[model samples]
Target: MEIDVEQYKKDLLAQGAEVVFSKTKNLTDTPFSYCGGCGHGVAHRLIMEVIEEMGITDKTIGVAPVGCAVIAYEFWNIDAVQAAHGRASAVATGIKRTNPEKFVFAYQGDGDLAAIGTAETVHTCNRGENIAIFFINNGIYGMTGGQMAPTSLIGMPSSTAPYGRNPDMHGYPLSLTNLLAQLPGTYYITRQAVNTAANVRKCKKAIRQAFENQKLKKGVSLVEIVTNCNSGWKMTARQANKWLEENMLSQYPLGDIKVPKTDN
Candidate 1:
């Protein structure tokens, strides 16, 4: 007889087996369109799980950016709005100001946040808007072709930078998270990765802290998850992940940049 994994897990839950893992209720059943081994799906699950665990599923409002996560509204069960390219931060600001009681967050990619929305991002944190920002930095622009993004490391090859990214001609990789950490308006700022189990747990904790800080009416909280873009990078998922470990981590080392005095 064929065994039913889903039903088996549920039956085990009924028998009071220690709950190892389960899908969050805040995520829709729609299949994700992310490329194989892409971190977007994992990121979505973590965010939804946090929302579900916090009992804020109803009061959460997400602003989706114009990159790979442009269709994020469909994947997330929570109410979401689509922002123009590089305008998620600006749009989220208006949404949060209008609905102060709701939890507001903007999800963006390197191209959208560091490149196009740089002004909005800087001003939002500087003003200390009571909102959270989830940034996914995959080096290259995954959607709309693999172009060289502001967060792309030096010498990284991209469609825009065929030979290689030259700092003299292209400028250095932009560290937006580090920049925002220095701003007094920013209450919490951390960078984590999703490639390893340990890092996933750390990222989840960071995300939880981000939302938790909002209860204190603190300023902007940024959680930057540095991930890999296998499709954009022209490598198999396994190879891309290995490359991310060797190269990406060196440039975007994961850690907390700023935190409240209580955490300090």
Candidate 2:
């Protein structure tokens, strides 16, 4: 006899399991346009979940930069603005300053954040902008083909680096999140992934904390999600995940880099 998966899920929900999975009200019902096995969808859902849970869906603003997530304004139910390439941080700063009561966040990709927006990112954090930054670090430029990004692994091959990246020539992979943590203006910074169910839960918690920090006016909060770009990596979804665990995790470990002081 075949097992009734749909009924099983219904049973679980009826049993008061508190919905192991459900679409957040903060996102549109339209299906996601991300490539199969892409982590952007997961990251989007997690952020929306946090916003819905916090009951701030109407009071939050998101700034999406030019990248795979540039269309975020269409997906997210809340008010969202599009920023020029690598300029999400600067746009978010202006929005938060002008509307201090609204919670503002910027969603950026590694290429947009670590390279073109480096100056804006550092300066915004240094100035203690009360905004959250959701950084998606997939190591490659997913939107513009598989090109090397500032956070790409040292020896990772990309369209631009067919023979793998040479640290001597390309320099080393930038750890922007870690660098941001060192700034006194930043109150919270963390690196997370969505490779597993457990990791997904942890990521959601970190995102929620970032939102809470904004409500407390605790300065800048940066949450870096080290995700997999299967298509850009030229690997199957499963293979990409495995490769990320073996290689990416070693260079960009998962954990909270910094947290707000309890005494404060």
Candidate 3:
């Protein structure tokens, strides 16, 4: 049964059925290379949609480093540059400073941001650089053989901590987003997720607000997305999402941690 796709869209439009969901042009045609149930793809879509909606597709620059989202440049249609492992935030600092008029952001994973790039990430926000950062915290290191990461919750098992994460042995999970929110240079900070439909909408709103801060020239705006690493966790997509909701959210709760002060 052959069906005409364009004509099908036309028929739906003729019936007065508005298309509420469609791929934003800010994304490339490249299919996501993430695992079947990983949240990076959904997180990526939210960011690109925000860029498109803000009409900054051409004026935007994104920096992605190592980990699961290393090939992010291929997915986002806007101008982007790849940085060395754990150097995305540092590189983004340079890019934003040189092209101060352009909107810039860094897309990084847990290991890349909270672990190796800890110094750069903290310093970038400390300086209150006018840029947004999107951090995806999947708990474990997804791309590097599922090793333990700085954000891995206590008692979570990983390749490095097969017995389960122990604070005495592995150190407690570092709530990086909360730490950044305390920095005076940081203008906006929030933690959100894409595990469910309702959460996805809220996460999208957070992403949009992060980008808007750039226009306002506010300091650093960070949005931490608590996500899942299904393959790394040795669980099916469905099982991983369920586990994420049960465990991950408890350590990294969703909602705004900091916002610009209102002068009423």
Candidate 4:
């Protein structure tokens, strides 16, 4: 018989209404610092919810980066270490290597991961590090004055690219899922979004799978969230959602890039 996991979860929660779910208490009560209509907050909440549901909050160690999620350490009530700009992957590798028992996750944005930290990200995945990377790709630098990021879509205007991202001048956007899927060391890789209820569900499932992949010591797992940066994109929350549907979703079609082979 197919089990109703949602109902089961709800039943469990209903039975202990007064007792806080361990993960719920781990996350901050205040609204996130992310800009309005920003996908970062939605993505963060989903991941946090899954982490709580799985009862892994106590053992998880998050490595936060310098971009919009630099203060992730403040929101997620777990042991966390702050990394320099674009250095979350490197920091995560060190932490996981030193403390193999803990669940290590690295949270970073496009500017931090695809730009300054590209080498570290690629190398860590190449080395088959047992860590999960939650990459938020909003296509521009949200914290640092809306500069064009490596993942910025073509024709998307930014402070640096006033005329939009030019092919000859700026090159192309980076597809992290597609790029990392080719690596044997990467056990789980998926592209997801947080624009709607349906997409949010998919993202949460992917994130849960990523964490499970890490728990099994399979290899590097990455969940690249095609998020929105309303502030940086210079669009209202509603406009940002519409833009994501028309622009971002088309460029970054969501799906799993890789899953561990059972025989492997």
Candidate 5:
């Protein structure tokens, strides 16, 4: 006999078991615009899920930069603002300062955050802005063609670096999360991935913690997610995940780089 998936889910719910999958109220019903196998959709869903779970969907605001996440305003049900290339952090800072009661976050990509937005990011963290910064580090400019970004691995190939990124020519990849961790203004800094089930759970927890830190009026909280850009990498979704596990994780290990010291 064929199992009734919906009936099984209903039976589980009747037994007081939580639903493992459901659409978050903070996210729109419209389909995602991201490429197939891209991690952006997953990240978006996770963030929205956290916000919904925290019951802050109505009071949270998101600032999206001019990268693949630029159109986030369309997907997120909460109020969202569009910032210029690499300016999401600055915009988020302003929003948080003006509306301290609201939860403000900036969602950005590697190219937008590590390249053109470097100064803004550093200064925002240095000034201790009470905001959450979600940095999606796919290592390439996924939106505007696959160009070499500041976080691209030494030998990763992009549209701009067809023969692989040369250290001599492109310089070494910027360890932005590590650099931010050293800044006194930052309260929490972590590097996470969404390529696996375990990592996805960890990533969701990290995002929730980051938002919780913001609620405490703490300094800047940065969650850098090392994701896969299958289209940009010129690899299938499965191949991209395998490559990310083998290559990207080594350069950007998953873990908390910094956290607040609790008083014993």
Candidate 6:
């Protein structure tokens, strides 16, 4: 039977179904711990929605990386484990390997995943770990000052890059999706954002696809979400959104870079 995606979403909204960000039992109420205009909050909500909709709350184990979302375990009401800086993928691999029956997911920021955690992320995908990875790419490190992350765009200014990112000196920013796409173990890889309503919907869909792929015991699935950090970016929440829409989107084109036809 064909599923009516539109009607299904409407029903979920009408039933007062609590997943994330609604009034009752919403994930947002867990606390406004994230900085204003931070993409982590939006990403958090999408993950919660996917878990609730898939009914995998009980069987899911989320690995939270050491970055801005270091304490994501506290906000997400699921089996969450904290990993050392840039080691969430390694931890997630262990958990998924040991508990094959459970669904494992890893969440990490640009610095954690693309910089320090690069080896783990690549090896995990190379091994085809049956897990979902939610990667937040905000260009700058939001937690320990606004430093240049591996994903920071060219000419983008950060605390570490006072003048802006210089490819000659700092090297090119890493493209998480493009890098993972070269690996055969990666069943799905997509780049999404949360700067606008349309993009938010796309991010949720990408996240949902990642979860579904993991449930099917498929290879690794990575969803890189270009999020915002208003405080770190030194812009108001509204201005940050505008900046992302005007600048970030061009560098990080939105869409799935790879997905096995069988998985689709």
Per-model TM-score, in order, reads 0.93, 0.92, 0.93, 0.89, 0.92, 0.89
Question: Where does candidate 2 have its weakest 10-residue lDDT segment?
Answer: 16-25
The TM-score between candidate 1 and the true structure equals 0.93
Worst lDDT run of 10 residues, candidate 4, spans 17-26
C-alpha lDDT of all candidate models, in order: 0.93, 0.93, 0.93, 0.88, 0.93, 0.88
Using lDDT as the yardstick, the better of models 3 and 6 is: 3
Residues 212-237, candidate 1: write the lDDT tens digits. Answer: 87788889999999999999999999
- Write the residue-wise lDDT of candidate 3 on 20-77 in tens digits: 9889898898999999999999999999999999898889999988998999999999
Ranking by TM-score: 3, 1, 5, 2, 4, 6
**Model 6 lDDT per residue over 15-72, tens place:** 9976574432325346758887788988998898888888888899999998889999
| Comparing 1 and 3 on TM-score, the stronger one | 3
Per-residue accuracy of model 4 over 1-264 as CA lDDT, tens digit each = 999967988897798856443436667866688878888777778878878888988888899899888888778877899999989999999999998988899999988998899999999999999999999998999898799999999999999999999989999998866888898889998899988899999899999998888778979999999988889999899998899889998888888878777785
Q: lDDT tens string, model 2, 1-264?
A: 999978998898898878656677888977888889999999999999899999998899999889999898788988999999989999999999999999999999999999999999999999999999999999999999999999999889999998898999898999999998989989999999999999999999999999999978879999999999999999999999999999999999999999888985
For model 3, the local distance difference test gives: 0.93
Which scores better on lDDT, 3 or 4? 3
Over 4 Å off in model 6, which ranges?
Answer: 1-28
lDDT per residue for candidate 5 within 1-264, as digits (tens), equals: 999978998898899998577788888977899999898999999999999999998899999889899899888888999999999999998899999999999999998999999999999999999999999999999998889999999989999999999999989999888999989999999999999999999999999999999878879999999999999999999999999999999999999999889989
Model 2 ranges with Cα > 4 A deviation: 1-21
- For all candidates, the clash counts are 0, 0, 0, 0, 0, 0
Best candidate, TM-score: 3
Model 1: CA > 4 A from native: 1-20
Question: Model 5: runs farther than 4 Å from truth?
Answer: 1-20
